[model samples]
Each structure stands twice: as structure tokens, then as C-alpha cells.
Target: MIDLNKLRTFTVVADEGSITKAAARLYRTQPAISAQLKDVEEETELVLFERKNSKIYLTKEGTCLFEYARERIDEIDGVVACLRNNRQNLDGTIRLGVYFELTSSFVPEIVHAFKREHPRVRLDIIELDHDALEVGLLGNDIDLGLVTTLKKPSFFETQPFYSFQRHLVASREYLSTVSSTLTYENIFDLEVIASSNLLSDYKYWLKINQQNQLLKQVDNITKLITVKDAEALRSLIKKGAGIGFYDDFGGQSKSEDYAVVPVFPESKPITINIDVARRKTRTQNLLQDEFYDFLIEKSEAGLT
Candidate 1:
């Protein structure tokens, strides 16, 4: 194997055409430079430099080795520079776990803006339900998460980044079939369109209403349709399939199709709070840490 230090010494001497000049350029003694060159020739069993007068010249073999050595060193230098530049630029992948519903929430816009700012930082977005999102984060399968519930608070650090009011809403077409005044009793009887795996959250919201005495019984949605994702839920809601609860942010609750008329007017609309979360014990990563900071910064700056 050729010693890079010796090969580098040889390349410099060839470039300067003098051991004295190469030594000054490299900040080494002339004798030290000459010794490295001698080791290079012994390794290759070829005299690389032919001293003409006081200047060094590359022999035919020396010229070939010089070209090879110069190319290798330059290539390595370029690679090192590229890697260092990437580190400085905070370029890497962030494995982001998000609740399926929040995928349609403000996350898209936030992610879009983040990507625009960090062109080199890629995101591996995994859509999971509230439970799976936390599981992924705790298991270290995901670098970070946007979770609605922090089930195991001791294991994670969370910051509430976004909050929105969730209202029990249905399309004008669906509401036309029901009484104008919606009671907890009447609303549950109507056809229900459920988003994936959010029954626990919905139950908690119901519990809030119960605490306020705004609702009494939670029994039946005689007809039910469970959608795969927020997009699918939107499609179902758009077609007026059944009544479903949705956030006002970019959801059907604000659309002309959904009748915003006081569904559960007695109780306050359920406020859904989303938290940006990560394991307290997770490994340190520059890209993930930068993005975690970016998320918090952007959220605090009213980007959410």
C-alpha cells in the first residue's frame, strides 16, 4: 500500500519541482520531505524524481505515478469537503411519525415550508394512528413524532405545537335528514363516519361533554363507515356519507358542504392539541435535532 503522506509529499515536490519549495508549502523540513520521497521510491521500486541542476523533474515512470497519486489525493479531498459541507448544511433524513388525521392537518403546510427552507433535508414520513405514532417514537423506529397523546409521559419530552377546535359536523345533505337541534342522543343515532383508530380520542371528547352535562348517553351509530385516512374521511364527508367530527383547520367543518350549525351547541367544541415529541433517551443526531428545533421555532413563530 502507498502511504498517502508520502504520496502527498511526492505530489507536492512534483508540483513545486523542488524539495525546498514543497517543504515550505507543506510546513515541513526539506530533509523530512526528501525522506518521504525516498520511501515512496522504495515502495514503488522506481526513482520518481530526477534532479536536473537544482530542480527536480519527474521521469517517465515518475510522471505516470504523479498523475495517479494526484488524482487519488484530489478525489479524496473532494469527498471530504462534500461530507463536511453536508454536516454544516444539516443535510440528512428525519423519520417523522404523524397521526393519520394530523397528516391532513397543518402538518402538510408546515412540512412544505420546512422542505422549502431545508432543500437538502429529506423526510421519511410514516402515517400511523395515535397509538402507533407513540410506539414508533418510544421504540426508536422513528426519530420524531407529532402525537396527539403522550401515553407514557416519563419516556418522552413533548411540546404542544398545534391546537384546533374539533366539532361534530355533517354535510348539509346529511343534516337535512336529521332534526335541526342536535342532542347527544340524536347525533349518535345518525350514520357515523369514523376516521381510523381514533375511537379512544372520540371517547375522551365524549367524556368531556359528559362532565359538562351537555351529553348523557353514548350508545349507537346504527350505520358506520371507517375510512382509511384523513383523505378518505374527507371524501366520505364530502359525499355526505355520515356525520363525523373534524377540526376546523382545513377540514370539512369550515367547508360549505358541512353544516356548521351548532352540533352539540351546549358543550364547547373539543380542542385537539398536537404535541411534537421525541424520546428523552434517543440518540443525538444533528439533522433530527435541527429539524426538531425547526419545528418548535416555526410553531412558536405562528407557522402552525
Candidate 2:
């Protein structure tokens, strides 16, 4: 029978692409790692690596085995964790990926509260852009994602955590110079500001608005101002840069700094959906379920 330790060594070598590096990471000798890999290859009756010019590359069969090796390793880790620890205690790391704008206010509170409740559980919170969040979720790198809902993928199960209305905002000084009532036609009259990376929902709204003559595309606005974070966008508006749409949850709290007004032909502000997602095949632990329940309770309490 092929040894599990040998498979682990092979997997580590394959992941690092160097036996020396893998040995350093695993705290084993380079020759020991090499011997383990050779034994694994011999047991499986397959040559796993191609050595050329002092470099190693995985063969076709090696690639397939590597995937199986990783899955088995994960299974072994799960088993070891279950056997070694008190299952009743809330433990293990939960990785959460959230939007950049939430880092300052909402996310910190949620993480603090959760940590207080389950002190043993390690919470890994990552602030990522929308695209990166989606990619991380799909790749199983993150356990949960908090983001605005543009288009829901069929694979993800979603829950509406909160609603944030979008409002047109500008500096008080800039608004002072303009007329009190703003129309769709006059939208171009003001310095228009918008988020740099367009979400799918934003694109949909833009397409419909442009088609209906509600908004005119201002190509020159790109040169004047561009912001990736919602908070930065609000700061720019406060600095008298330009008028832009800002989410209520993120922007409403800073209303004193800028003049916020409703935009006309108001495309329904997209719902900011916070979803708890995982691989369909994976069963959620008690801690994960409890945290999900806590979030639901918090949402119902309107703490968001």
C-alpha cells in the first residue's frame, strides 16, 4: 500500500515545484522528500515528474494524481482535526471576504462581535474587490462573501442582508453653484463622477439609462476623477471633485461632509446582498451554522 506520508510529501513537492523548498517548508531533508516521492511513484506505477535543466515539471498523470492527493490530504486533515480536538468547542479558521468600503464600519463590528462569542474560532477577514471576491468564492479560497448583488450565479445560495439606496452626491460648494432642481438632461451639466470598476448591475443600469436618454456618457469625466473604493469616492466628492452615486449604507453616515440628493429616473438601487457560500458537497460545521444564525439575527435586528 502507498503510504499517506509519501503522498503528502509528493503533494508538497508538486505544490512548491521544488523538493528543496518543500523540505524546508515540511522541515525534512531534501533527499528524504525525494525518496518519499520515488516510493509514491513506484507504488502507483507512474513517473510523476519530468526533470530537465535542474527543474521539475508534472506529467499528465502526475497532474491528475496531484489533485487526488490534495483531496485526500484535506480529508486526512479533517479527520485529524476531529480526532484531536474537542468537537463541541467552536474552533477552526473561517475565512471571510468582504468589500473594501465595509472595512471601516460594518465588518469590524461584525468580526468583533463574532470573536467575542467564539473566542476559539479564528476569523480571517480579507478586503477584496467584487471580481476578486467572486473568484475566491469559486475557487473555495474564502468561506463567506459580503458584496452587492449584481447577477447571482446559479451555484451560489444568496440571502438579502441589507438594502442600500444609491444617492447622487456632490460637495456643498459645488451644489451651491447649481440649480436646486436637477433633471436628466442637466445630468451632464454637472461634473459627473462614478465608480471606476463597473459591476454587472451598474452596467445594466447604465445601458438602460443611456438608451432612455436619462444619462449621457461623459468620456472626459474619466480624466478628471476616478475612484475604486466607495469611501474614496465620497472623499473626492467632499473635496469638490464631482457628483457621483454612493451607496446609502456606506455614504449616508458621511452626509455632513457632502450634499446628497436623489438622482432622477432613479433606477432601483441594487440590493447589497451578503451571502454565506461554500461548496455544495461540503457540510458546514456547527460553528459555521451558528455564525450564520447570528448574522441572521443581527440582520433582523437591523444592526447592519
Candidate 3:
């Protein structure tokens, strides 16, 4: 029989890529870690690592085993946590992942309100960009996510909570220098503040809209300003650094130094529908259900 402890030790060693480092992390001797790996490999009849220039590397099979080991460990930990807190009414941790824009403007309020109602429940909020959010959700790193859904995933289920609109905004200072409205030719010259994923979407939209031809002659590459949060992007716009896009909900919620202008030729305004997504499963917690209900009600009330 394969030992779970041995599998765990192997995973740690593979992740750290050094037995010495893994031993330090696991608080065990290097020999013990090596022995655990040897036991696991012998039991499974598979060599999981390759030694190159005295450095350890995971073989292809080792990589596959590492993924399964990680997921299994996470599942065991979650089950243990749930069981330990089962008797304590509503006294457990809930992991929440959210998009960059909503993290600063909305999530704090929601968390505070929820915590006030259920003081025993612990909330862990992880602020991630769109790509990171998706990756975390798929990897089961978070229990729930609040984000804009551009594409639907087959493995998960989602409930739409609220909708917001995207706006094309520019600083008043930049607007004063340009013609009243931006033509495609001039739009390329203006600095474009965008998140990496948002920029990809914009490029896709431009291609579909057949608006790329007008930008061919422009020398200024559309300046892509990467921001960790929506508020950060707004701050950049307030300084008159560049024109960018932002959620209308954010713009209305905070008073900033910049002026917002609607983009000319009117690209279809994107509607951001925040969805609560989770893996489909039959086993459900009463608290999880109640929290989902609360979110649905609050979202319907438009309380933000």
C-alpha cells in the first residue's frame, strides 16, 4: 500500500526541487525525506525524479503525480477542517476570490457585513486578476469567486449576482489637447491603460469591428498600463497619465481627480455580470447555502 505520508513528502521534495530544502520545510532530516521518496517510488514502481548536475527535477510521470498529490492533500485538509468545525455553529473559514476591480470598491463592505452577522465565521479574501482568478477557481484554491464571466466553464456552475457597465474614460487634460472625439487614427496615439487580459479583449474587439486598419500608420504603440486593482487604474487616469477603461460602478462610487469621456464611434458597452461560481457537487454545507442565499438577496437589492 502507498503511504499518504510518503506521497506528501515526495510532493514537497518535488515542489522545492531539493531534498535539503524540503527537509527544512517539513522539519525532517534530508535522509528521512529521501527515504520517503524512495518508499513512494518503490511502492508505485515508478521513478519520479531525475538527477541532473546534482539538481533534482520531476520526470513527466512525477509531474502528473505531483498534481494528483497536491489535489488530494487539499481535499484531505478541507475535509479535516470541515469536520473539526462541524459542531461549532457557523465557525469555519470561507475562502473568497474576487476580481481586481471589485476588491477595493465592494468586497470589503460585503465581508464586513457578513462578518458582523456571523462573527464566528472567518473570511479569507484573495484579490486576483482575471487570469489568476480563473486559474485559482479551476485549481480549487478558492471556494467562491466574484468576477466577470466572459466565457463559461463546463466543470463549474455559476450564478449571476449583479451587472455593471464598462466605460471608455479619458482624463480632462488629455481631452483638452485632442479633438472633441477620438478617431481611430488618433486613438492609437493616445495612451491606452489596460490590464493584460482586458487588452487582449480590446484587440479582439478591434479586429472584429474592423477598426485596426485606421491604426496602421500610428507610431505610438497603445501604452498598456497594468494595474493590480481598478482603483489603481483610476488613480493613474486621475494623474492624466493616459486614457483607459473602468467599470461604471467604480467610477460612480468614488470621487477622483479625472474626468470620464465616452469613447466616440461607440464600441458596444461591455456589461460585467458578476457571478458566484463553484464546482458542481451534491455535498453542500448549510452555511454555504445560507451565504449563497444572502449574496443573491443582496445582489438583487443592488446594495453593491
Candidate 4:
């Protein structure tokens, strides 16, 4: 008989590329993980990994075993979820991935309200980019993903949560130094600050503006400060690092006041739809369904 715990540990080690990292993720010590790996290898009589330059690489057999092991683990999890649902249990960890701005600004309130209603459910939150959030949901790393998109993907079912505008913002101190009125052309030449993410980077911002026919009007940008996430970008912008972009929801909620003024008041503000996404193929338990519906209701009521 195969040990499922060993298989689960092996899959985590394979995914993380380091036993140390896997141990940390699985909340086990390094020696325990090594023992599990050794036991699995002995049971199969296969050399599952190669050690080179103090790092472990999966062997061909390891890769094959890992694929099957991961699938089995997911199956087991689904079965457990179904059993819990049959029992009408709503006590389990619900992992969530959210964009940075929403995580800091609005997600906490929603989470608090949800937790108040369902005291037995545990919510684990992870911050990620819009695209990374989708990947996390599809890969089963997170049970739910809160993100914003111009178009929805076919693989995931998305419920529209909130609507907001992306604004070009500058610090009041920085604006006071500049004599000319803020316009797209003038703002592009200034040092631009932006979040470093697949969807929030300077190029994506430029691309979206180009699609809106506003990019051609602005001058070529040479100066930019890319930060790790929206929170960092907001901090930098507050300190007068450079002009940056912020969503209206965050702009209104954050106390720092980034001074989000309309860049080209004539052109309509960019409209962004925030959505909560879940994998269409995965089966949600009663708890997951309830949480999802709560978010949808709040969004519709303008509560979040």
C-alpha cells in the first residue's frame, strides 16, 4: 500500500524545487520531509531526484510519479470536500488570492463580515497580480481569486464584484512645483511610478492607453520607478517619487491622499471591473458557495 502523506510531501517538494521550502510550506521539519522522501523512494526502488550544486532536481521517474501523486491528492481532497458537504459541515480553510490594492483596501471588510457570519470557516489570504491570481485559482493553490479584468477567461467563472476608474495621480507637493496644467503629454515626460505586475506595469498601462487612443498624444516615457505592488507604488507616489496610477476605490479609501486628478478630463476615465473568480471545473462545497454569493450580493449592493 502507498502512503498518501509521503506522496503529498513529495509533490510539495517537487513543486517548490527544495525540500527546505517544501518543509516550510507543509509545516514539517527538513529531516521529516527527507525521511518521507527516502521512504517513498525505497518503496518504489527508484532514484527520484538528482542532487547537483546543493539543489535537488526531479528525475524522469520522479516527474511521472509527481504527476500521478498530485492528481491523486486533488482527488482525495475533492472526495473529502464532498463528504464534508454531505455532512453539512462548513468548517475548513478557504484559501483566497487577491490583487494588492483590493487586499489592503476592501477585502478585509468583506472577510470580516464573512467571518462574522461563519465563525467556523478559516480564510487564508494571499496577495497576487490579476494574472497570477487566475493561475493560483486554476492550479488549486487558492480556492478563490479576486481580480480585475477587461474580459473574462473561459476557464474560470467570474462574478462581477465592483467597478472603478483607473486614475493618473501625483502628489500635491510634486504638482505645486510644476507650473503647467497636468495633461497626458506633460505627465508622460515626468518620472512615472508604476506597480511591477503583469497587468499593472508601465507597458500594460501604455498598451491600455494606446487602445483608448490616448497613448499617441503622450510623449515617450524614459523615467519610471517600478515597485513590487500597488501599496508600494502608492507609498512612493505619496512621497513624491513620481506620478503613478491608482484605482478610484483605493484612492478614496486610503488616507494618504495621492491626489488623483483627471489627466485628460475630456477623455472618459478608464473603467475597470473587479470580479471574484473560481475554477469552472472544480466543485465548491456549501461554504464556498455561500461565501461566493455573499461577495456577489455585496458587490451588487455597492457595499464593497
Best by lDDT: 1
- The pairs that clash in candidate 3 are none
Q: Give the worst 10-residue stretch by lDDT in candidate 4.
A: 196-205
| Top-TM-score candidate index | 1
Q: Which stretches in model 2 have alpha-carbon errors above 4 Å?
A: 1-89, 150-152, 179-182, 197-211, 214-220, 250-259, 262-273
List model 4 lDDT by residue over 174-258, tens digit each.
7777756765546667777766523243445556565445554333456867776667777887777777776677457345473
Whole-model lDDT per candidate:
0.78, 0.71, 0.75, 0.76
- Model 2 lDDT on a 0 to 1 scale: 0.71
TM-score of 3: 0.61
TM-score of each model, paired residue for residue:
0.64, 0.58, 0.61, 0.60
True lDDT of residue 232, candidate 2: 81
- The Cα error of candidate 2 at residue 203, in Å, is 5.5
Instruction: Write the number of the candidate with greater TM-score, choosing between 1 and 3.
Output: 1
Q: What 10-residue stretch in candidate 3 is worst by lDDT?
A: 214-223
Which of 2 and 3 is ahead in lDDT?
Answer: 3
Query: Any residue pairs clashing in model 4, and if so which?
Result: none
Please give, for residues 201-278, the per-residue lDDT of candidate 3 as tens digits.
455446555777743443346456767677778778767778776677745723643365655536765666788877
| lDDT, candidate 4, at 224 | 66
* Candidate 1 colliding pairs: none
Angstrom error at residue 168, model 3 = 1.1
* All-Cα superposition RMSD per candidate: 12.8, 19.8, 20.9, 20.8
lDDT of 2 by residue, 1-304 (tens): 8888888889999999998899999999989888898899899999999998867999999999999989989998998898545534678888888776666657778888888777888988888877888777778888777766424477676565665655555666777777878665555667666655343333455555563444334443343455656678877776777677666775554655435544453555544556555445456677666776777777777765
> Model 2 — TM-score against the truth?
0.58
